[model samples]
Target: MKQPNAAKQHKPLWTKAFLLTSLSNLLLFFSFQMLIPTIPTHISQLGGDDAQVGLVIGLFTISSLLTRPFAGKALDSLGRKHVLLVGLSICALTIAGYSYMAAITLILAARFVHGIGWGMSTTSLGTVIADIIPAERRGEGMGYYGLSNTFALALAPLTGLWLMNAYGFLRVLQLSTCLALLSLLSSLFITYPKPPMPFEKPAQRPTLADRLFERSALLPSILLLCTAVCYGGIVTFITLFGREAGISNVGWFFLCNASMVLIVRPITGLLFDRKGPEWVLLPGAFFTIAGLLLLSYAHSEANLAAAALCYGVGFGSLQPALQAWTIARAAPNRRGAASGTFFSANDLGIGLGAMALGALATYCGSYAVMYRYSVLLMVVFLLIYGWCLWQAKRVVRLFGRTSN
Candidate 1:
């Protein structure tokens, strides 16, 4: 790894840059999230079936996934502030465009554009936080930075649903655009870290390898894909899933879910920094497995909320823990690449999961049955995670014995 930037200095956690950037993250996420539930409903309103709904939802993720590799390179080469503002501008325009789109094809097209904005903005935000935070405190800092989104999560679902109910899809799209604009305005105030000077003379042209992906972060990114697959199922269908059980509002579940995430996010980050991934992830794996199992059987508000609490705690802790691991292992100069790689894997899994789960729901004739498959995926993830850990230990022991 390159030597840590000599300029990195100890600063208080809540600097103006961090605060403003966090606010920007919060607002951007709110705008993006407000459409999550509403969009599927809107697709249905436009005469799209569940399969078509999945296609529209999944396309956004596919678009973002395709762009993340390029966005990562841009974060490193272009100024963070510039990339950020451009992303916000795109988000503002694309969100407003949704209001004008009546056909399913048009909505899908708009979602694709919107995903590009989402991919760039989120990648930059994570990289910006990494640039500013102290290395020793990165786990904690990432967890705290994530709080902006998690806190926003607490409100976005209910508010989005409420807007849809009160003002309809068109107005929801309009209000979502306003939120994106606010995110852009807040980003304008964020202090961009001084751009790092490249250690070597610039190449005339970069190769495909450098532009494509970050190698050091691949392990964590792949692992995250496993978890994100299950998360996608929840994000894409939980509203309709709840309605399947006679509950019209999914706010309570998200409320409980976000609350648990809010509570554990910082603590798990601290634990990851202090005690390492083994301790933090073991419990997380258990929580995730149990949560999915519970969710598959949810039939009442109480049961649904209980499932949310479990999933939230698991997901909340694991995401930052894994992200810290990704960035921690990466060379400082390539953190933007790491962030991009991580989020790309994240979006890929979500997109595929939504599509696959939706198809399964269609074949099986209900979302509840599809969730049973999500539970199985979670279990498989834990098994894979455990096997990888065991293999790592075996490799370490053999290397030690050889050196001896």
Candidate 2:
């Protein structure tokens, strides 16, 4: 029950390492986002249809999901730095490979390879941070880390689109490859902390409760899954949807959305550190739900902009809170597994949601239908979470009474 002492805890070496790692992730994500706005269009240019585009995008996620458990276990055994370097190097190479391929199949292969690298890098970096950051400040640290990616998400797509318009897709691809290489190089400067070994003895097996509940840890994980599902719908289909709705300059909508996230994330982090996640969750959820609704009804550029602001605020606030909570409740030895689990759920929600939404859009003849469906899903998640919170409080009260 004793909380880590804030005054006594020194600035951890892993914190600096995590900052570098986060920067690498930022660049990597930036490069990917740069490609995102153009990828479907490129696939179309290459004579692929919507189904093929969906397949290509889905391949990346499928590869990532399949590799995560292995990546997590490897990070636990092989150490973080080794896995980090391997992942980043592979990522850099894959980005370069994109330039050499015009075939849809080859592009899908490259994305799959990129997904493997993403799985390794993300799992290792998260595990390494878990080893370094203090529980009390974990929320704050994770928030800052999340901000790095959000910053990239904000700038990368617009910049990439502009460059693509100016110089061409080939030149944009070259820029992305260079950024990925920079990310790979950045890993060399990161000094990863030594992670604890896995428990070996039969008696050292974690309890059923530890495996199932993770108690407070489940809070963030569930919230993350919900948020990811919502985000997946927007990120994957919004631009295409906008184009369908006869909106011009769909890229600007993404730019505004990312900008709002970048602006709001740090403030949310500060709030999480001082006020706890409970206070932040409801408002964030509201914004997201509202954003999705507005997006569904968006008939003008102004409506799209308003939706972006709402969506950004919602997403920016909740993501870090969930990450911090997941790490905070995990035992140090199992933190890698815990982070993997968290990310697995996140990946599953996002990947599945996108795929399903794509299918729905195909049949429904409107992206708005998908948005409405997601709003329903969000409502379900909120109900489940609310019930869980109530149950948790009841258990705590009962335990306190029995103890007394």
Candidate 3:
């Protein structure tokens, strides 16, 4: 009799909290994605040089990176619901301000504010969802939760590009503001338990050392950084690479990539739960390596699409696998810090990769050459992932002998 009620106490993966947070995440990502490609064009329009474009795009991520540790502290101290709503509202304000800006300095300024909001919102949302999900089912739930961003990743850029051509930058940003507002409203509907305190009450105020990052999450976060740098190459230069390779239309590449991601995400998460991270991450690395190599020499639309498929499958699977593992291994009360650590790694990887690979592309004489070089990072990821697996096996063997 108690068993059934015990089950009832555990929320379904698709609880109101999950749905609202996911929808809010979708809206937030949609608004961000809608502006991503257009921002560079806008920078160019403002008479900024290429280096300035890099600064404009890169600074947003820098701000996000800088804010994540503080956001994590806030999420742990404040309620998840409180942090989430405030973050969304901040994002909404920053986006609205973008609609009224034209100068490069103002645009860069808005991006900085938007990054703070973005960092806070994403960190809180990940922590909140980690709260709702049962430990056993975290991988599955996070996989589904990531779909909202996947949908946005698939659709937003096309819409943004279309809108820019048809309605102009101001109009597109106005629409972006509307989407962010919708995110805030959705966040308002979420009801979640306050995040529990991480440890016994301290005798004094927590120090700066105590305020940032979760040590338990650091391993997977570091591993993710390697793969994420590889991803930066694709996100930053895939379109230009396609053009360089004589493929005029690259929209289908993302559509196809999103399709594979949708198909494999749930499956990979299920695999992670049953078999552990090694099985999922190792093969995923190989897929990524193969994809990058193929992308280097792609000529036909078909080869390009194949690269998208392989890379998408690899990234889609490994990303949530890392996220679930990061939070799952964290102390129960420290999910917020775990999430912050995870995303900070993401921001760090993407920002560094974008700049490093951008320079690498210039030195190598083409984006194609740069992607081929990016494979070397994925190779390092494989080595690190292998070490993680070895460590996992050693622990399992140690436990087995102890039990015996």
Candidate 4:
């Protein structure tokens, strides 16, 4: 028999879509991170306490989690570009609303609305990428895509703080709003490949398993969720915790963390592409566990720097690995659903962790207590990650046996 022609293999339209979508995500996340370091301070300015700040941030995750399934369905039925435009428009409007809202409740409501838009947009983008990139290259592609957001993380917060100090909060808000609008403009340039048509009969919808999982999906999704809980706690409260510990310029911590992620993410992505997730994930988890533990006892600026380096390396490496793994396991037609499932798990973990950490902080009367608690949570996550690694090895062995 003639060998199949490898020359006929061509880069698909989906790859182009992923590139544009990644750019859009980068701009959108840049706008978001610009606001991250300032949100708590804004809440306080509007007469909200730490508990209220927690609610405001936690509610955004809740809104996103609640709408993710619907967004997935919409991606299947409505097409990616249509869903994306609607989401970006709404996100821009809600963010503008946030700029003007003075009441904590109104601000929370605006954030919740923004979260809905975020859920829809990001879900559609991931699905669009899945439709474009090849399965074997998914990990590498996803890692490249993730770097866009990582770039935003590295720069946005520090810029925001500088603007806040140099000018005023209103000026910072204006800059943020401009970035959101820029994302909207960039998104208009993104084109999606033809989406799978909607099911003719709503009742004939595929089961969740048929939509989200086929082979290695479950393990990666679970791992991402666990990591998200760790992420949520740190991003939401790290500044406050640092301030409480007498660390001035807490924005520097975010700066350092994001910078490290931007630097390390590409190298890790290459590693994932070559050696596979098993090699990257175990060490990633250990780094994260160490970071959280160090953060628990951190007081001096030097300790904070150490913790940021550890977190940047660990969580930064793991996120792209998990995302790529989840997409790699799903059928081509079901990539949107798989993305939805992954993001939903992520949203839930972050939401729950923020709420719990907030409550703990309220009772304990110190942010250090929250960090200590997070260390304990990381321990649990480490144990679970170990079990997942064992299971993944067994699955590989079984597959090898069957192939023989």
TM for every model, in the order presented, reads: 0.87, 0.87, 0.93, 0.84
Error of 3 at 396 (Å): 3.1
- State the lDDT of candidate 2 residue by residue for 1-404, as single tens digits: 23445454445534567777788878888888888777777888899988888776788888887777677766766777888789888888888888889888899888899999888777777777667666666766777788778777778877888998898888888999898898888878987767875456547676744443334455567777877887787878877888887887666667778788777877886677677766667677888889889889887898889888888888877787777767766666667667777787788889877877879888898898889878876686678667766776787898853210
Q: What digit string (tens of lDDT, one per residue) describes model 1 on residues 203-266?
A: 6776776666888888788778888888888877888888887766676777888899999998
**How do the residues 23-117 of candidate 3 rate in per-residue lDDT, one tens digit apiece?**
98999999999998888888898799988888877788989999998888788877687878888888889888876787789988888888899
lDDT of each: 0.83, 0.77, 0.85, 0.75
Q: How far is candidate 3 from the true structure (C-alpha RMSD, Å)?
A: 2.7
lDDT of 4: 0.75
Per-residue lDDT tens digits for candidate 4, residues 278-375, read 67787888888878877777888888888888888898888888888777666555566777888888888787677678788889897777767766
Model 3 score (lDDT): 0.85
Q: Number of the top candidate by lDDT?
A: 3
lDDT of 1 at 400: 55
Steric clash pairs (candidate 3): none
Would you list the rank order by lDDT, best first?
Answer: 3, 1, 2, 4
The predictions' CA RMSDs to the true structure, in order, are 4.2, 3.8, 2.7, 4.0
User: Lowest lDDT 10-mer window, candidate 3?
Assistant: 395-404
- Stretches of candidate 1 off by over 4 Å are 1-11, 43-52, 100-105, 197-207, 239-250, 361-369, 391-404
Candidate 2 displacement at residue 253 in angstroms:
3.2
